[model samples]
Target: MDIKLDAAALEAFLRAEFPQVAGEYTVDRLTEDGLVLRMDVAERHLRPGGTVSGPAMFSLADVALYLAILSRIGPQALAVTTNCAIDFMRKPAAEGSMTAEARLLKLGRVLAVGDVLLRSDGQAAPVARASLTYSIPPAA
Candidate 1:
């Protein structure tokens, strides 16, 4: 399917719908099949041992896949995550930003499945990987 939302539109949607996280995440790149997103790392995103926290990385992955689906399906604010499986692969730099690359594996009438690869800014290796399923609200 063709993209229904670009990077700017996704950013605006996030700012409007999720103001709390608007400043932390950025829609960096939107491709035909996926998108790249970045999350600014801060004190709140770090854990003991000076690494990015798992929850923070998971959030990035979730949002990335959510936006990836929306990019193709248009703005579906009610789309909800039905399932998520994440693997914490490596320690992310405590002070670096985190970037997620998400690709849709499948997009159906009611469900969208995607995977996200997250890495610390400037890192070549991924720090986490996540697969998610979102239940899209039925069209009115």
Candidate 2:
């Protein structure tokens, strides 16, 4: 699918629509596989074990897939996650920010399905993997 929004446009859309989380993530690159998003890890993102929290990683996966769909479908903030399943495979580096690579597997009229792989910056193995399904609101 053709990209409807580049990195700058996507970032702007997120900042405009989801200001609460826009600053936590950066639109790193948009590639053929999909969009790559980096989550800026802060103390709040860490768990007691000195690793990134599961929710933090899940957020990266969720947002990454959301942006991947928006990249193809335009900025549709109403698109909401309908279902999600995540697998935590490894511990993320506490000091390094995490990155999520999201690929759109299917984009239908009312639903979009995608998968995401997350890793701590510079890590070879994925820290988590997720498959997400989103319900896209009908165009107004």
User: Model 1 misses residue 76 by how many Å?
Assistant: 0.8
Q: Summarize candidate 2's per-residue lDDT along 36-136 as a digit string, tens digits.
A: 99988899998897788888888999999999999999988899999999999987899868899999999999999999999897789998999999999
Candidate 1: list runs displaced more than 4 Å: none
Q: Candidate 1: lDDT of 45?
A: 87
Alpha carbon deviation, residue 31, candidate 1 (Å): 1.4
Candidate with top lDDT is 2
Candidate 1 RMSD to the correct structure: 0.9
Q: Where does model 2 exceed 4 Å of error?
A: none
The Cα error of candidate 1 at residue 28, in Å, is: 0.7
lDDT value for model 1: 0.91
Model 1 agreement with the true structure over 1-140: per-residue lDDT tens digits: 79999999999999999999878889999977789999989999888878888888888999999999999989999999999999988878887688999999999999999899998977899988999999999998
